[model samples]
Target: MDRPLRLIYCVFGLVTFCQASIIPCKDDDTKCLVSTANDIYPKIMSGDASIGAEILDPVWIDEIDGSVTILKYKFERCTVAGYKKCNITSLRIDAHNSKLKLNLMCPEVNLSGFYDINGRLIILPVQGNGNFSIDAYSYNINIDATYKIVKTDDRKEYITIKNFNFDANAEKGAKFQFDNLFNGRKDLADSVLKFANENSKEVLQEFQRPILSITYKIFIKNIYKFLKAMPMDNIFKQIYPKLHSFTCVRASLTPPTPCKADDTNCMMTIGKSVYKQVLTGDKSIGAERLEPMKFDEIDGGLTMLKFKMTDTTISGYEKCDMKDLKHDNAKMSFAMKITCPHLEVVGTYDMDGRLIVLPVQGKGKFSIIMDSYDLSLTVTYKIVKDDGGKEHLSIKTYQAEAEPIKGVKYEFQNLFNGKQDLANSVHKFANENWKEVTLQFQGPIIAATFKKLIKNTNKFLKAMPMDKVFL
Candidate 1:
């Protein structure tokens, strides 16, 4: 009886010790991350019931709609296989920024589903309603994700994804098969499928975005379940530690390049470095994070043309190029010309009145992309003495001017009470007349953006002495 009781106790302890099978990875340990992922990939692919993880080998998607130039297609009740056999080729974890990237490659991925297709696939007319299958050979996927840690009411920590992006590629291309084409006429179906398979690369490229969009959704859902069940510390042996103010005060500061009061070139170089650091939320020098900059709301447009945007998130500012920099020691001021490849603004909007010539009214989600976004900024500052008699730069005035060089793209969902045709027409008109749209809209937008920049710069400068920045 004593021996049996001891044996039972040992079994219980073993089960408790094996609660998490994944080997933990230290912060930013790429090798460990890859090894751990590889070790657990099979279990995750097969669905780990303990973690409530779903089987990913046959990832399911209810529906997907996509268009390429003139080609439009839809797939329903899709199931994709071969994920179970995928290998993690690379893994990069930037735990400091809560960002992770991993590469997955498989010999082949098979997709089977019901399809309704209409449109020109290259020169061939593709119109069909039946079953379909695609064999993508040498399939590869690159995934990038941003995540945040959430604490439950019971004080348990979990990782939740904030943003996710991915793209798919197949080196050996793909083969497509569509059944019951042209009312079960086999000849026409064979010809189209043959042509598509011959030019598989191009055909697959056309549908990649839509296909991957579904892939991202399903992939995130499963990964989220796995991550939620595993605590942050369990997945990562260590989380990147934040720098405290006391430590930062004693740390050595190195300029990107040597800088002087009137050196515009050096200033530009340093400005670029500082901008990047601030964007990443470097607390070492008291710089505030600007990535995914959020605004509760911004009100603008003509008095009659009242436009309000809420829960706004601005991104793509990191792609900015400092075209020109000017520093004036006499006035303690600086002027800069910064151009970004694009600036993306996403938010919910409430608008009433005329946008240029068209009368527009809506309250819905909006996404605007400003291409070749040129911004000019002029900042004037004055030296202020702190309690310790240390001098710091205080912003006196901030000014900004902006222009969209290439043009702007607008997507407003649920616009005009879900008037699809009307909203699409409005989008076309706005895109065509983007200059007028920018002219009417850029002022308040640029002002609000620069306002945040000024606030962040002041915060950093307040922590830094005037001599430190100039010298």
Candidate 2:
């Protein structure tokens, strides 16, 4: 036989025996099903074969007269004829065969004497210890099978095989104990071997149904075990990538509305009520505004969203202040202290944002961040999708500025502690030159603060799906 055929036979034989050791379904069993399917599918597609298991055991074949017990039946190889397809509904195995190396311990069976030339009578006793080989054939095997999710007695759901049945003809070829029993009688030995071969089909047919049934049970049990182990959510995601999108659309359309004549791109609308819940309830985009998120538009694979936000009280960064900052110039060298307790920015801004689906680019911003100085900010940001399909925000460009506000305190400490007059003079000068001071420090400080904010925002966006923001 060719190398590929040899390998196929070897794998088949091993898997046949190994199938007996399948365990019951467990909580995390889907991996085994997926792995087994993956392993089998490629080999089947490539016209190669691999063993799912290997085992050592004795097999017994019972007959009407007596039972033949194989002392050590070594499954040598198994090979199936080329098949086109296999699925949950049915499986077809063309004319397939397997080989076995058998060591038989056959007891002596008494036979009536036969007269030779009407002169001498000879009695025969069948017994033997010799190397034996057997070949099993399964012809035109067809199986009708179905897949189902069944709940076990323990209330756990498991994928299972259902309505399993098969049709096939089984035939066998065996090198019986002819050489040992009928030695020196070539004619008798030949006759005995022929009879065994011809009648072997009957014996094979007798056991074929039970064997196939057991094999199917073993395979099905393994599949059940695998499905039981895997989580349902993961299984759904693997089977249906757009399942979440379908769910989102369904949830949005509880009370369905009519689509407009020109609204071919509109998936669903987020009305005022749902928009409020989505913005306020979401921890990532804690948007607060009187206006609602209007109709979402999709153009050439890009999702555009328009929204307005105003007077948002976002918590977490309650206080940000800088103390003991020394500034040295040609006229003065003194430590400056500036603090803004409960720092926050309240502003009104509108967004015209577009989310590119294919390349996953996000553009446009309303007000990204604010401070107590009523200074609003807008940034160019991108939505990055990781390898695992999770999205995060990254700030590309930010506009930073600082405008002097009255009542803002500035404390200056002179180089010499006793120079109280100099310290007062320095403080007065700093207040008088507030615009220059603010311009000097505003870029670096805002840049640093925005960097930290972007990092935190990215993490928050990653934790929550971007679709939730639109919903």
Candidate 3:
């Protein structure tokens, strides 16, 4: 079939296939919008792998970190359930103005994760890391978004959300439970839990921003995927002849040549090319801009040190050099090392307790200039045959390590809460002990920094064949 005919057939087939759940609606048809949402919510949340829409309910979140006036918290490996139970209480769609709003309510919702917390909570010190559970009754969520129609170079049109806001509230408040608080001290843990439950409403209000921010990300991502597959113009109407499925777009890199199995130097050169593309982000290849990498929050700690770093930005990656590359073809693994002469990290930090017996308590802006920083990464992948019978590399997992070879300089503003002399003394002392401080906390920082690196690498590799990338 020709392109036009195939598209027509697809539209006809889709209408026939989804007629029970979906139908054409006018731009201002509020009843149609709500009815259609209720009908197709289950299918959408169940996910359609063909369109690259991953499962939305029981959503998996890798990490979430945020801070309020006095409390900082981090959650990892979180699973949020109950969105599937939500009902669209109200909805607004103004296609003429490129705006959308949705109001959802769920009778009950639950979240479980590993959490790390620091700072003060209602006149009590809150610090710990362990399993956590939060249950909210009669949860409500409101989403508002405005998007622009973007026409891609391929002449395909998609909706790019310009502004998004997500708000969450609970009718019956929430309950919080955290295990292993204060190193599993039953007495203190009981007291803290009791107090938290009593003040759950206020506490939830304070932490709602970060939590809802992540939920917003999840919803927006799915919306983007759905809109991309079914363009904005075709979303509410029966005509979808131009609908296109989502797929990874590969970067335009130097042509590949077959390399000998033991040619490590050639591998290093190819690795450099991949890194450049991944680091710089090529829109042509669907890579997001990463020149000045940014992270909203990162939290981790040692025995005595608990810290939160927020609004962090790191630059100077373009000047990095690939030091070494090694491959184990039989084992399907690769290890590489890179060194950068300088990297500047700027962020605000909230820290408490001591590091190596040095008092370190602060909440303010911080700057760290790392000299001769080396990063090493080990990646293991498996080759899988796609539906088309072409082999692609699927990254199983990756490990990253960073070390500052020469030294590091640190400057923090507002230490000791703006005591000039005390802040200066602490800064001097910290600069002298930079290595120890970094050693205690750099593990998580480095991991957070390289998360995008690994993700982009995998993305780049996923769009190509193993032979194309390595051989």
Candidate 4:
């Protein structure tokens, strides 16, 4: 009797363990289904992916009259949407009457059948095809689906659609069928085809129900295969790398320590080596300064940096045509030349105790020699990072003062024949044109040049693995 009692207790424990393991398997299946549905349904609705069917053999046959009717139907290029032009709100397991809208084209449905005469059913084999289209407002569908877990022959579990049903309706004008059967009376055949087409709603309703069921079954099988192929634990590890402890390095301090405790007061020095590496590596900005960079720590997590470039030649090419200046009445046609031989910048930026967001404002002075008369300019600009992790620079204000310099001249052989007054007039006109042209080109050129700068800086900061760089 004691042996029998022990056997029964062991059996109960085994049953409980099996049931507990099955619970998690069920939960995982549910999660996989929901994730796949959320990812795939939108693509099908947007026409990015298509669902369709094709049948080649004859579908219907009549034995009494010796008549054979072959019907071929397909739903081609269908785009699904929500009811009343709204977006699909939700999709869930065991959901019923989920409304959907489909815009589809039914192209060239072929039919072959026998026609009846006044007294007898003639064996006049008719073959014809017609195209039909469904408008967005006219076609509407309601769907019901439920899923179940099944064990395969290999004892592996899978999720599959157990039941699926749908009903659809379309406007009368959306129905079309062809009848090129009668020997001589084409109009009568057309009338018959139209009549058949009018009642086609019922046929379509029956055909679509099974197609949806098959589609959902395929979807469920694919999702299960995908989940089994790659586990979720590996995916999460790939996205989020291991976080390591990092600290700021200061030359004045005894040694570097972790910044996790007091990140707000930590100051990571941007030494000359880092500055030279970043500036020299970026070919787009083409910045080379002989003097060492000056960095000052300021209040409110801000840093001030002063950069100077002497005897530097900045050259850029722009395709200039007469048509670009559409609003200008002068219609002056000459090559546009832009250059800056010397430039200086003083900027202040706040990192907000984080490496992600960098906001910078600066004032710059540059000398521009456009074709001839030397012009000195001062401008204020701001560099901002957008939500999509792209950096852009915009000029807020600009001041340009042009003056004629001795021995500095421009030669437009055809327009100005070396006349001093005429040359001066052209230079004056060019200076005025510079204002508008500068406004148009400055934003794009600066943005492109600074893109490499911003990217390299962000990479360097993040590479430090420090929580905060105070200045």
> What are the per-residue Cα lDDT tens digits for candidate 1 across 1-471?
122222211111111121323344455466876776676566555443323344466665657888668888888767787888889888776645666677999999998878998889888987889998999999888988776667888776665678888888888999888887777778888888889999998888877788888776766666675555444333323322221111011112553444555566666777776666656655765655788788998877432257888999999998888888877654445678988998899999998775654667789889998888888776655667899998776765554557689989988787789888878888888999998677666556666777777777777767776555544
What lDDT score goes with residue 132 in model 4?
28
What lDDT would each prediction earn against the true structure? 0.68, 0.32, 0.68, 0.30
| lDDT by residue (tens digit), candidate 3, 370-421 | 8998887766555567788877766654546577788899888887788888
Select the stronger candidate by lDDT from 2 and 4.
Answer: 2
What are the runs in model 4 whose C-alpha is more than 4 Å off? 1-40, 44-137, 149-163, 171-173, 177-185, 197-200, 206-471
**TM-score of candidate 4 against the unseen true structure:** 0.27
TM-scores for the candidates: 0.45, 0.26, 0.47, 0.27
Candidate order by TM-score, decreasing, is 3, 1, 4, 2
Cα lDDT of candidate 3 equals 0.68
Query: Model 3 reaches what TM-score against the true structure?
Result: 0.47
Worst 10 residues of 2 by lDDT: 48-57
Instruction: Compose the digit string of candidate 4's lDDT tens values, residues 1-471.
Output: 122222211111111111111112122244543343333333222210001111011112111121223333343222221221322232333223222121222222222322332221122233332322322224444455444445567665533335545554543433433334454468766755555456566544533443344333433343333333222221112222222332333222233544332233331222223334555443333433213222232122111111222322333212111111011112111111123332322233221111111112222222343443333322222334556655433322222323233222212222233355654554455355554323222322233333333444444443332333222
Clashing pairs in 1: none
**Could you give candidate 2's per-residue lDDT for residues 259-319 as a string of tens digits?**
3322322322322233223333343344222122221221121012232334433332324
How much does candidate 2 score in TM-score? Answer: 0.26
Task: Summing lDDT over every window of 10 consecutive residues in candidate 4, give the lowest-scoring window.
Answer: 48-57
